[model samples]
Every structure is written in C-alpha cells, then in structure tokens.
Target: MNKKITIYSENPFYDKSLKTRHMKATIFKMVTLSSLLFSLGFLIFFLSDIVIKGLPAFQQTYIQVDVTYNEKTVKSTRKAVNKEYRRLVSRSWLRTIPQQVIDNPNLMNTKIKLWILADDQVDQYLKGHHHNLKPKYIQSVDNLVKNNATKLRFNIIFFTRGDSKIPEYAGIKSAVIGSILTLIVTMVVAFPIAVMTAIYLEEFAADNLWTQFIEININNLAAIPSILFGLLGLAVFINLFGLPRSSPLVGGLTLAIMTLPIIIISSRAALRSVPDNIRQAGYGLGLTKIQVVKDHVFPLAFPGVMTGSIIGLAQAMGETAPLIIIGMVAFIPDSPNSIMQAATVMPAQIFTWAGMPERAYVEKTAAGIMVLLTILISLNAMAIYLRKKFEVKW
Candidate 1:
C-alpha cells in the first residue's frame, strides 16, 4: 500500500501578487475612462459653443417702413424710406429698390408699407451683440422694438444671395456651389484613375523593386503636406499648362492630385479585403485574370471603394490650404457657371468671413462652420451606411 501525499506548493506572496495585478489593471481602466470622458467633454463644449453663436444668423432683423416709390426715390434710394429710418435700413437693400421698381412698373408711385432689411449695425444691436451704432440710432432701434415694428424674420436672402461687402447681404451660395463643382471635378478625375491604379497594383502587378518603389512613393505621397500639392499644381497645372489660376478646374485638378494617394491606398485595402479564394474560384471556371477581377472581385469591393472615395472627397472638400495656394481664395461674389470660372469653396469663404472686422461676421462665420460641419457629418454617415449595408460577413 503506497501512501499518496498531496503536495500543495503555493507561494506566500501569491495573493499579494494577484491583488497587485488587479490594482494595476483597475488603474489603467480608470485612466482610459478619464481620457475618453475628457475628450467627450471637450467635444460637447465645442458643439454647444458653435450652435449658440450660429443660431442667430438664421434670422435677420427687418423694420417696417413706409416707402414711396417715386421718381426721386428711384434716383436716390435713400429717399425711398423716411429720413429717420434711412440710417437703419441696409444700403445694399436700398440700392436694389430702383431695380425692383424697374422690373415691376406697378410699384412705381405706390405708397406701401414694407418690411426691409436693416443695417448690419441695426441688426447687431437688435440681436444683443456688440455694435457701433450711434446713440441716436440705438434709441431709434429700441423704439422700433417697443412698437413691434422691428422683427427678426427668417433670412431667405442669406441662402439665395452671394458674398457681399455688407455682412447682412453676404451669403454662402457661391461658396457652396463652387464646392459642389470642385468636388465633382475631383471625383470625376480621381475616382476612376485611383481605382484603376489600385486594382493594377494590388491584383495584377508583380511584386518587384519597381513595384515596391511605386508603392513606397504612393504611401509617402499620402503623408506629404497638402500645401505641397498646391505648389505642384501651381507649377504644373497653372504655370506649365496655363490653366486658369483660381478656376474650379485648377482647384479640382489640384485636389484630385492630393486625393489620389488617399483613394489609391484605401481602394487597395478594399480590394485586398476580398479573399483570394474568390479569385481562385473564378480562375477554376476558366475565366481570364481581367474577367476574374472585373466580374468577381470588383463588385464585392465596390462598396468599400465607394466608402473610401467618399471619405477622401469629404476630406478634400474641407481642405483650404491647397485651394488657397492655387488662388481659390479670390473673392468670388457670383456662383460659378462653369468649371473654368474663378470660384471659392466653403472653407475659403469661411476663412474670408472670419477675417472681416464686423460683429455680424462672427455669427456668419459660425453659421458657415455649422453648415460645413453638417455636410461633413452627412458624408461620414453616408460612408458608414454604405459600409454596413454592403458588408459581406465572410
């Protein structure tokens, strides 16, 4: 009979070691959670500040005034409104009075009460912002407020018009349209070329020194400062090719060059995500390599490719440095009708407005930022939706 003794070998510090490990893990988790919370707090603060400052720009102050559209008023728009209200009314709005009468002859010789746009100073004072309004003009605005003659109406002109020297008359229409056109050109030029380059490099090209060099350059281009691309565009497109300096064509071409590396990298990743077995299956069916890639692999990768393209476009849409370098910062007051026309994008417009020395422009700048943020958020959401919608589980 053998007496079996159970040997219990436990270190005396085992419990202490376990407790120490647990304490370290708990501390790490707390640190990470604090960092996450801190980031969220800052985001909330920034969003709240932007919203609060921007909301007022959607409404514009209008004053009810009696306008006599006669010969004298047509000659001198200041005579359209009464003497006391002339200082309160917007000069830009008043300048349009003669044209309005010319377009509608019935308005001539009519004594009608109308709600008209107020001066930027009057608008600021009404919105409780800092204004350089004279004491008399401030008192006049207060009186109108008391009598319910001044009201903040939805600013339809802000959406319909273009940039103006007057803050109240300025709008983002030109910038918005320019952005759309520039993005269109960017997508049209970059998308097909990038996808083809990515397909060739990832699917067909042999892995050699030349291929490795190209791959390295593409990666390096992605990391290059965007402003350098602007310089390249200035040198190649504008200087060498003689493309219009501030045109959307030049801006788009420039942005396309900058966006190419991003789309290529992302498209390659998308193509690689397709399993090799899919290609093998296509080849088993006696399909050519091109047919295998075109018919079998591309469709599956299309969603991811689109997602990356959209994200890249969104990034390009918000970029100002490159466009500014190519002269897209020019003050384009009218929406561009063609790609060859000089244009300014939303970011450039925002930059311009942010520099203006007016209290009203502060709200306009914030509002422009809000609009830009909304568009960017929508684009990112679209990318997410596309990824989720077409994702293959396998």
Candidate 2:
C-alpha cells in the first residue's frame, strides 16, 4: 500500500544554520588544538635533542682509591721523590696498584682495569699538588680514559689546564681566553659606536637622501653574511693595517663590525618605541635636544640595546667561518697572553675538536659545546631578565 507520507521540512526545530555554526566551531577548535600540539611537539623534540647531545660533556670519568703514602714504595719507585709531601698523588700511585692487585689476588679476578686515568694525571700526582687535592677517603680508581668506564666528578680543572696534544688534556685553555678577549674588544668598540650613530641618525641627522642611504646601508650590513666581515677584517685589519693574523683584536674588530648593524637597528627601534608625548613634554619643559634624547630616549632604549648587544655577542661567539678565514689557529701553542697573540674562539675550538680522528675527542668536543651553550644560555637569560626588569608597559 503506497500511502502518501507527509515529509514535513519543519517537523522538528532542526535549524541548519545553527547546526552549521556548531560544526564550524568544532572545526575551529580542532584546528587550533592541532596547531598548538604540533608546535609543542616540535619544541619538545628540539629541546630534548639539545639536552641529550650537550649533557654528556658535563660528566667525566674518575677512579678513586684510598691512596696512602706508601713511603717505601714511593721512594723505591719514584726516584728523588719528596718525603714531606702528604697529598694523594696521581698515576705514580698506579705502580702500587699492580702490586696491590698482585698481592691481594682477589682484585686480579675483578673487572677493574688500572690504566683508566690518563698518563698526564699520573704525572701530575707524582709531581705533588701545587695545591692539595686530598679527599678524606678515595675509593681508588683512575679518571678520564678512553671508552666509557666509570663516571667521575666533572673536573673544573678542565677550565684551568693549558693546551694539550692529547684531546683529553685539552680544556677551556684552548679558546676561553681568545673568545673572552674578542667579546671584550667587541663590547668596548661596538657599544660606543652604535650608540653614537643611533643618536645622530634619530636626533640630529636630517631626514634626507643621505639619511635614507645610511639607513639602507645599515640594514644591508645587518643582512650581510658574517663570513664577509671576516674577509673584510682579513683584508683591512690584517693586511692593510698590519694587524696580526688571527689575533683576538682582529677577531673582536670583525665581530664589532658585524654586531654594529644589529645594535643600530635595535637602538633605533627602541628609540622609536618611546612615546612622542614624552618628547613633546620635554620640549614643553625647555629641555635641549641632546638632553631630551640622552635623558629620556636613551634610557628607554637601553634595555633593547642591551638585548641586541647580547644577541650579537652570542652570534659572534659561535662564528667559526670568519675566524677561520682570518687564520685563527685551532691549536694555540700557548695560552694567549695578549690580544695580539694568535687565538681560536670556542666555535673554532669546537670545529677543530669535532674533526679529530679519535672518538674521545668527540666527547671532548661535546663537552666544549656544552660549556659554550651554557655561556650562551646564561647571556640570553640575562637579556630576558634585563628586558623584564626595565620594560615599561603602556
């Protein structure tokens, strides 16, 4: 029986418009949630990778033995050994290890190998400490040898030691002095020049063709490749000015030039961010142009300027190509005593170490990288703190 069924469009309150709106809202929320999750995932992955790669450098290997001054053994084994010394010495103590293990026989079957510590550490111990390194009771094992044997205290002495042919012995001495000296040079030179230029352009300079040209140049300079500045430093500072090649002074000057554009741009932006009403108020109060800009404009821009300077320094700190072009020595024969002496920055040191044939050097390079990353992170933290401290919300 084909009965005519009443197919009413408004049988129920089925508002297609409201239904469509609800569907759109659901889609919008899903899209937003998806975007947020994707962003978080990328960030987590990146941070995890960096931490994993960088954390190993801070860990070192060591073996601690309850080293007693076996005077008879010391006298017999170490020719001309000092008797008055009462400090736990290095690998010279190892001579006792073989005999001790031999006499005990229990240790002979144990898995503890004696040659875990590097030979140089052994030499240092025999020489006696310039300072006392005596711990109350050492469990007795060698420190910092090839392959992952045992984890030991992270040695801060890595920072104090001189350059070594052995990668294990190489520490911050290779590039710390050089990198620091370069930063100092950059700060000393860059800050004044950038501040002055910013002031002139923003305050005194006419809004004309020349000013436009200068602005263009500054922007272009900021965009220029860092290696080009290294080339420029090589050509001008090293060649024309007869500055020593690969000297910290040269590296600093090159970095300063590279950093200037950023400083100028940031300073300008900071200056512009200041309220025009403040400038007008200063004018109304009969302040000179210099006084108004210096007292008001500069103070407002200080935080931004600092932020830019720090970022620039961080960039320069990690630059290797430019320093390489300028003949920065990856291996400095001695610790640099002056800016004129040849030097390698931390990045250069890292580059050199990463290219090392030995696997141990890979760890050393990673350690060096960890150190570098610490410095950068600390600098960035300081910048953020400064910005927060001085930020004036409108």
Candidate 3:
C-alpha cells in the first residue's frame, strides 16, 4: 500500500537539460552578434575615413582667361613661330575660358588656370598658315590652379587624366592606363601559370619526398620578403636583361613573382577539397586519373582557385614597395602606349603624391586609396559571387 502512493514533483526550472542548452545557445548567439557588430563597426569607420580624406580629389578650381588670336597679328614667318600659329594656338585655350564663363555666368567667379599642353601645340597653331582664328573656334584658356580650390568638389576629369605636372593641365590618363595594363599583365601571366602549377601538384605529382620538398619550397616562396623580389627584379630585369626602368612589364613581372605562391597554394587547397570518394568513384567507373581530375576535381577547385587569384591581384594592386624598387613610382605624364612603356600604378601614385609638399596631393592620395580599395572590394565581390554561382552540390 505504501509503494502505491508515489509522489512526483515538477520543478519550476523544468527540464534542466533544456535550460542548460538554451543558456548555451543564448551565449553563443550573443557572442556571434557582438563579434559581427565589432567587425562591421571597424569596416564602416575605415570606409568613412577614406571617403572623408579623399573627397577633395573630386573638386577642382581653375583660373579662367580670355585669349585673342588674330591671324593679322602674325609677328614672325619663321618655321617655329610664323603665320601667327604659335601665339594663336596658345591664345586658343585662353579664348575658350572667357566664352565658357560668358556662357555660364556661374563660372565667372570660378578660378581657372591654363593647362600646360606638351609640344607648345598652341604655338604651332598660332604660327601655322591658317587664314584666321575661326570665330567658331574661340580659344578657351582655363588654367588649373590649386587643386583644393572648392570644398566638397569632385573632379572626374582629374581621375581620368594620366600622371603629370603640366600646371593645371595634367590629366590622370596615364595612371588609369597603367592601372589597367598592370592588371591585364598580372592576369595574363599569373592566371594560367597558377592554374597549371596547381593542377600538376594536386593531380599529377606523386606524393613522394621530391614532391614534398617542392611543396615545402613553394610554401617558403610565399614567405619571401616582397622587397627581395624587388631587388631581384632590379638586378635581373634592369641590370641583367637590360629592360627599361619603370616599365609596366617590369612591374608585372615583379608582381607575378609575388603572386605565384599565393595562387599555387590556393589552387592546391581547392583541389584537395574534392573528396577522395569522388576520385574512387571515378576510378571504379573506369575513368583515368586525368579524366577523374579533369571532370570532377578541377570543377570543384575552380572556384577556390579564382578566389585566390583575385586575392593575389588585390594584394598586387596595392603593392608599392616592389614597384618602388623597380622605379615604377616615377611620375608618368602620358598614358602608356605599350607594355614596354613606363607607368605609375595607383598605389605608387598614391605613395608619391602622399609625399608631395602640397596638401592637395594628400587629398589625392586618399582618393587614390579609396579607388584602390573600391576595386579590391569589387574583385572580392566577384569572387564571392562566382563561388556561390559555381559551388558544387553533394
């Protein structure tokens, strides 16, 4: 009878195991949220700083002038200065500014400075045997003065012009061209070589002592000082091969050396992510090793490989030390016409401009950093998108 009356109690914190699990889950979520907030805060701060410091690169101020070119006022008939060509041409820019200001009165008070055109092109036009300064072709003279003339100003033109010191006239055309060329050169030389090396090591090479040594060596290459590569480039490309100093080709070569290890390691990792079961299955199906890797392994690895290459490119894009050693930091006035042509990359340009005595250069450097970072982020985004797009499902 006593055993039949068993008492059962329900605890208020019922199911202690559930309570403990809930507490742990709550802690994990809090930690994860806190970490995410901290990371996002840091990123926002960095981006805000870059934008604030670089905003000046967009705004520009110049000195506007009215130029007059009368063919009747031809002073000399010499080959250099005859037919009112030289003066008329010089006067051309000056004439255009006044008309611009007249057409847009808001520009009247805007400071304008005439840009220094190479070859004294205005002089040539003034000296040429032109009948008269065409009324339709009134010369406009707007000289670039201080780059920091307007607050919160954005100058798309300055970003487009190449590196130059032609007073207010210099454009970023050269720097833009050089950046594009540098990227192209990097992709061309680095992409295929990286893919091939990765394939050989992952799919072809035997896992023996020699291969182990090679792997060790490749890893070591990643740790080599970038400056050492620069020194190597200086000696090999400049001193030994007699390549031109400051050429994009030299920059590309140095960057390739710097990037190769990254690409190799990344590609190998990608290839290894392929499950061994997949390979075994391919073999059971009577597929060759090459076919197994080509059809199954390579596809899975491509995403990771592309991501790694993009990361390497991002690093290369921001590299300045190696380029400094190779003389790529020099100011280039015109856009590069060929790979052999000398050029300045955005990072190099930013470095050089940051050291300039003018405050304007500081803003420009900040702007350049922003641009460089933007491109890197874009590349990363592309890699992420590609990863999601091509990721294999099990």
Highest TM-score against the true fold, candidate:
1
lDDT of 1 by residue, 1-394 (tens): 1331222224443454666899999999999999999999999999999999999999999999898999999998898898888899999989998899879999999999888899999999888899999898788888888889999999887788789889999999999999999999999999999999999999989999999999999999999999999999899999999999999999999999889999999899899999999999999999999999999899989999999999999999999999989999888889999999999999999999999999999999999999999999999999999999988877
Off by over 4 Å in 1: 1-11, 14-24
RMSD of each: 4.6, 10.2, 11.7
Q: Report the C-alpha lDDT of model 2 over 1-394, residue by residue, as the tens digit.
A: 2231233344475554876899999999999999999999997897677566545545444433233324444345432122222122333344555476457755433333332333333323322322123443122212322334334456654687655565445677758888999889988999899989988998789999999999999999999988899889989998999999889999999999998998898788777778888888999999999899989878878898888788777877888888899988557746788898888888888888788765545656667877888898898898788878888876
Where does candidate 2 stray beyond 4 Å? 1-43, 62-116, 119-151
Taking all chains together, the TM-score of candidate 3 against the true structure is: 0.69
Span of ten consecutive residues with least summed lDDT in model 2: 79-88
Q: What TM-scores do the predictions have? A: 0.94, 0.71, 0.69
- The CA lDDT of each predicted structure is 0.92, 0.70, 0.69
Give the C-alpha lDDT of model 1.
Answer: 0.92
User: Top lDDT: which candidate number?
Assistant: 1
Candidate 3 lDDT over 1-394, as tens digits, reads 5542332124454554776899999999999999999999999998898898776455543222222323322232122222322333333234344455457666533333333221222222222312233443223211212332112224555666676453224445677688778778887898899888989998889999999998999899899888989999999989999988998998898899889999999889889888899899999999999999889888878888988898888888888888899999887877888889889888888887778654445556787788878888898898788778877666
Identify the superior model by TM-score, candidate 1 or candidate 3: 1
